[model samples]
Target: MKKLYNIALCYQGITEDKSKVSNYITYIEDFKAQIKYIINLGYRLVFPKEFYNWYKNNNFLKQDICMIRFEGGLKSIMPAIVWLIENKLFFGISIIASREKSGVPEEGYLSWDELNGILGSGFCEIISHSYNLKNFDLAKQGNNIISVPVLELPAYFDNGLNLYLKGDSVPYFDRTIVESAKAFPIIGTDINTNNLIKSSIQFITPKSFDGVLLRLWACLAYPVSTGYNAQIRVSINQEEVYSGDFNAISYPGNIQWPEMEFVTINFNKEFYFEQGKKYNIEFETLNIGNSSFRVYAINNGDNNIILKTSFLNGDNLDGLVPCIIIGDGSGSSWTLEQYSNYVNRDCEQFRGATNKYLKYKKDITQYAYPYGAYLANKDGNSISSVLTDVLSKNGFLGGFTVYPSRIYDNRESEYIIPSIAVYGNRSNDIILNNISAYIGQLFEEIDLKNIIWQGILGYDEEDFVESNKLNIIGVTKIENYKKKYKSQLLFKDIDLEEVRNQDLSVIVNGYDGININCNTNADLNYIVDLSNMFKRYRKKLELTINIKIFDTQMTNFSFINFFNILNNCFLFNFKVINNNKNNFSNSVDSLIKIVNNICTTKEKQKIMISYNTDSIFNQSNNISELSLNEAIIKAIQLGVKIQSDNIDYFYTANNISCFMNTSNGLNKLSNKIKQNGLGGISLY
Candidate 1:
């Protein structure tokens, strides 16, 4: 039996001329034909409740399921709903709650009572589209034209580097004034022609300020009594800003430390330095007479604070850059604060919608981003973690974006599930054919091997796949497993010579998993470079990544973002470890929920739940032995596999014929596993 495909089809109005938006709006006759055509294709129309329930339960259906979603909660959609009710079909409506209060007939918006009536029919499942879709759309586009009252001051970051409030001023001096004993040659007139120094420091302007000034500590190595005619020039982006005779410069001495003398070179003319723009400050000094000056380079730890510092002639003192200070401009900070406040208020409106939906006894668990906009600001930055956090808090399990793809195995996040747009501009044949093509494409892409068709919906694993032999056997040490299992082995430490001699099929981590520290930028860059490498490689090699969560309380969003970066790079196999507490079910349940929330449905099937037999049997006397077996079986049925270190535990504890040593036990265990459609496991 072919595995059934899940398709979520969304439509707008049923009327031909309901609104100006013709993208999703289909005529009444056209929608009727589309439904009939879908029904003819052996598709079962499910309400949102049923669809989400099936998805949450990990219940893959044997027959294709179609979820009909209507947007805007328009009155014109009601006529189609009547036809759906008469035909005994199920559908969902995404309501713009703000429009419901107005209940404008000309606008085609439905009243709350009307929506409740449709809900009572048991044919319609309602979800919040948004509080005010219009305003949300405008705000997402970086417009400040919102009807709702907004916060006065919003939190803004300092040039997208530091988070700051409205009152917080941008730091004048970027790095700490740590003076180094060593000095670089800035002006050496006493020496040869090569002694002329050219030094430059490039910095990204942290914020818009009144004036720009470059200050660095400089001391005369050899002071000339007379005829000190050295020319000193300061240029901003190659344009000269300051020029003077070296002897004419006034050096201010520190009160406590007289040797810590510094020269402040103020620009002769005020140059407008835009916020976030990189500017180069060049200091060129030529020797005309006998005068020698050396600039004291400061050793600052923060390399990111100031971008780059270079000395052409001397040692490349990377982080030891000059100090740049800007004049105070708190007013400009307030302008940035206003924009931040506007964006926050827009996010707050999402929460407002969640609150309003509770009045109708409907908790919105899903969101369809208006206009399919996922960006938080006008500049297309990374997908808004702030916005996703808000939606996650508001009970949104996931949101859909019209990215024109099937719900892929490697998705961005639960917040950015891709959906294909079905425009009413096309004919019913074309729309239905397009959906069919998507299903076919998905089947070809996510090709499940040895599938058992008849038992697709049942927890009986036999209905999913037909395989008695283990596909992958993983071990910490290959020498032990290779001599025993004698087949495909995934190893942490691979012996290339042993592999060649034994003719063993070995799976090694694409990027040595042990070396990865996801928290560090260097490790992340390594993964990125590897991804690009794999993308460019001509031949396909099986790429596998191993991720162990040592810190259970670690922030998941960072991991989510990391996985998003490696979305198409590799397939992840999860090995769930049950600690010595003997509470295996809790660990299994928690990991399952985490995987479900983080991974797409297709990826979920690829996940393998590994159990350390030592942890479970260490205190097996007090453990719920039967419950452990049940938990393992449940995980297997949910498309998760169990890889135990000891194969004897299943035979001894559960009294099952799973002992690999005996042919009867191995055959029975393998049959049970094949029948249940469990993802292949590894026994170390």
Candidate 2:
């Protein structure tokens, strides 16, 4: 059984002065009794350094343990701590190193001398809560935006007409009036005609577009001798889009018989157009003298397109279309980048200050993030990298997050160790109940297959080893295996190289253990491509993946999540291994309890536990498939390091338990072993 433990945080002590008493403060009497009750419950009280040492060496305790931690330098808590020491109990104290060292002890906070005296007693472990209470000042958020150029989508719309071709030109005709209609006519060079007020051409926008409308061009020829300006109004479904005017001199043309060109009216605003939508484009001629312009167009094969003069429809001038084009010229685009120099600099400053403080004292090396602020900036942008660097550079082995989570040596990094909070006002029963619950919760999350059991067989313990144990063999370097064995196949083998040739689903359906060894990002990408290929044919895969991660892999959260998502595909029944080989063991009872509580019969077959005194990859008969408990016992019979010598320790460690951070560069984790000598009640 993996011994389950907790780190309890107490802030202040119940004092006669109501001002000093808070919800977090415990009555000195209740606190002392709670400590005694915990001890009576068989939990060994471990100091901060001891706990850290056991964790680092994988020398987990065979018995239940607890580490009580006190936060702040509040003076009222001194008596309770003294009571604990006088009774030979141990606990830890986390202090803000930046607090005034010369302050009077009675002024609510402990002075340097008082804190040192307590430490001298050899009962209290001191750690850093932070340099100061607020860690946000250590790093400011960076949220400024920087711009970069990006490609822009094309912005021209063609109205589905071959306007490049022009129709036959119309001569100067008489006053042929037409009824009120959505049409317009343009007399050839008519500057004296007061009858026609506005000339309009209707066309549809060819595609959806969004951009500034800089210029509108029309295929027309006009007499510039009159020197009068012309107006062009564009609208979509009766909604005005653009209205502008232009003079002949603006285009620099001849006074008489000016050449036909794509004359444009410049627009100062933007417009949006939808594809296949009808638009009414109207044009007007402001004749100051006897001057006019001729309208040219392509053949109107479809009657759906209309050209009109507001006064008289050009019935004589049939089968003609207007040529118009819109342009948005010399436009630029922007892409934004977020800035975080302020955050980086602040983290650097914190590192410098923290190192300077630790240079002389060297007693405190661990820090608890104030309000969990070091996880991110106020803007919620992750600054974990910066904080991690700062902590590492300052020689901190670990940091605390107060995040209320069970700490697994394999899951959380050393920098961001999670801690749970303890209540001070609870009854003895309630406190014990909470402790039991914490232990159960912690046990439930232990990964059973990863534990390492190391021991050589004892003379009397040989009965635990079964000679007929089943061994599910593992194979690697499959190319070599296939070449050496060829047609002389004796047993089934999992060949990973086949994945590159065959479909992933086909391979998975044909084999049990799917070995995916990814050494770099490229290999990970290959695995991703294989998974994508599998998705094309099936919705799910019943797979057993043994993914091997090298040093360059699994360090990233993204990489872990990728495996997590893949595990989801296997219904979360997948095995993952990294470069680190030192495996830690939990109690056998914890594993059995986990299986009994959650796993079904089918899951039992998939739960693989490896036990070998030599190499885990050894091909000798040393590999055996004893039951989970028997295997653990067999490992113990060999020379495996366990938590305790008392066999009953495994059975009772799960009972009512209790669960520190301080400085000396220490972090605490708990219970990792089993023995059969000390008899206890069989909870199993």
**TM-score of each model, paired residue for residue:** 0.37, 0.35
**Which lDDT tens digits does candidate 1 get at residues 255-362?**
111123344455677667778888776777755555455555555444543323222434455565443333321112324444444444544665675355434555
User: Which regions of candidate 2 fall more than 4 Å away from where they truly are?
Assistant: 6-10, 14-21, 135-362, 376-385, 425-429, 441-684
Query: All candidates: CA RMSD in angstroms?
Result: 26.0, 29.2
The Cα local distance difference test for each model comes to 0.46, 0.40
Q: What lDDT would candidate 2 get against the real structure?
A: 0.40
Off by over 4 Å in 1: 16-21, 53-58, 102-106, 135-360, 376-383, 408-412, 441-684
